[model samples]
Target: MEEFNWLQLLNPEFYILLELGGVKIGLFVVLFIVFAETGLLAGFFLPGDSLLFLAGIYSEGLMNQFSTHNDFLNVTIFALLVSLMGILGNMTSYWFGAKSGGYLYSRQDSFFYKKKYLYQSKEFFEKYGSKAIVFARFLPVVRTFAPVIAGIVEMDKKKFMLYNILGSLLWSFSMIFSGHYLHAFFLNEFGVDLKHYIEYIVIIIVLFTTVPVLWKILKKQAHIEE
Candidate 1:
């Protein structure tokens, strides 16, 4: 028997999400994370972007999640369900923002919620116009609050839903499919298993998703100082 390393405990796919939840319920964990990341203000900490990617590797195209045996069928069903969660999550966030926009603006920051993120996402939405809805889906913190900003502004429902659906599908499908096919390519062609380097993969994904946001903040501060 191989000894389990505690460090791998930090890797959700390697230990927590998949092992704890197993195939039967792991899919729900994935869906909930996706929903929360976009829908809840405090859900900004959720590793939604990376989870989608990792799901492809561990979920095996979510075959069991949707009760499908065919390869294409499984992928389609899994992607759609994931997208639905994202869409619904955005709608929930938007609704919350619409109802409590003033209170949110006055609320104090805490461990889970930050007003800066809201302001930053507002700037992003203002700068990008309606397209921010799509761009935010890939960016971590921005995605959490972009819909909120949209809602606060009272964006047209039809327009918001249009971009929301497009953004959710593109983000979910791209991440999952890339993870699925890319993992297979590496394993089959080069014989490298991503699971072996889960920690490094997590670090890389985190950096890829977050560094840009930090950099932009730093650059804006520099401009202010100038």
Candidate 2:
């Protein structure tokens, strides 16, 4: 894993091979990744926002990689498709929680599994409601766990999906097209090019998202000791 770009694992070439290997893998990787991020307990570290943003940016370079159409229209279509994939993934995760999270919360469960990660998310949902879905979509770690927690805590499915779709659309497309278009706009504006700006943009997004999480963590710790 250290030797791999890991990030490139999400590239179109990788997806083509996933298809060739008989996975019927039409955006399923993106689907699963988003689902795991939203629903699975330990998936918060996965790069949901950055990945979508970068996927949009890389689609132009990957036209030949997947032997697909090279135009922005095709790229936009693909990005939107995957954005829907991500939303559906979260819905599946919600379904998973609705189906099984109850059992995990019942008397048969052990303390570690019952008292740890799952309950934290449950508390977050209990405290926030539908607003949690929107706010959590922007937060990295909590975003991954929020929707599933929403399901486990018995959030209204219709309302959850509504918020999930809205947030996913904005989060996925805004970052993706903004990076793609803005990078192009800036490069074309300068005499030559400023391609390295993409890396800066990603850093800014990550730091911008992560700071609040860090703040919340520190705030909670301080309250605990007081």
lDDT winner among the candidates? 1
lDDT of 1 by residue, 104-123 (tens): 78999997799889899999
Off by over 4 Å in 2: 1-32, 39-42, 63-72, 102-120, 191-199
Model 1's number of clashes is 0
- Which one is best on TM-score? 1
User: How high is the CA lDDT of each candidate model?
Assistant: 0.82, 0.64
Runs of candidate 1 with Cα error greater than 4 angstroms are: 1-10, 14-24
TM-score against truth, every candidate: 0.90, 0.73
Which lDDT tens digits does candidate 2 get at residues 35-129?
A: 66755543555566666565555556534345456467766766677667668767876887777776656635342133444555666677888
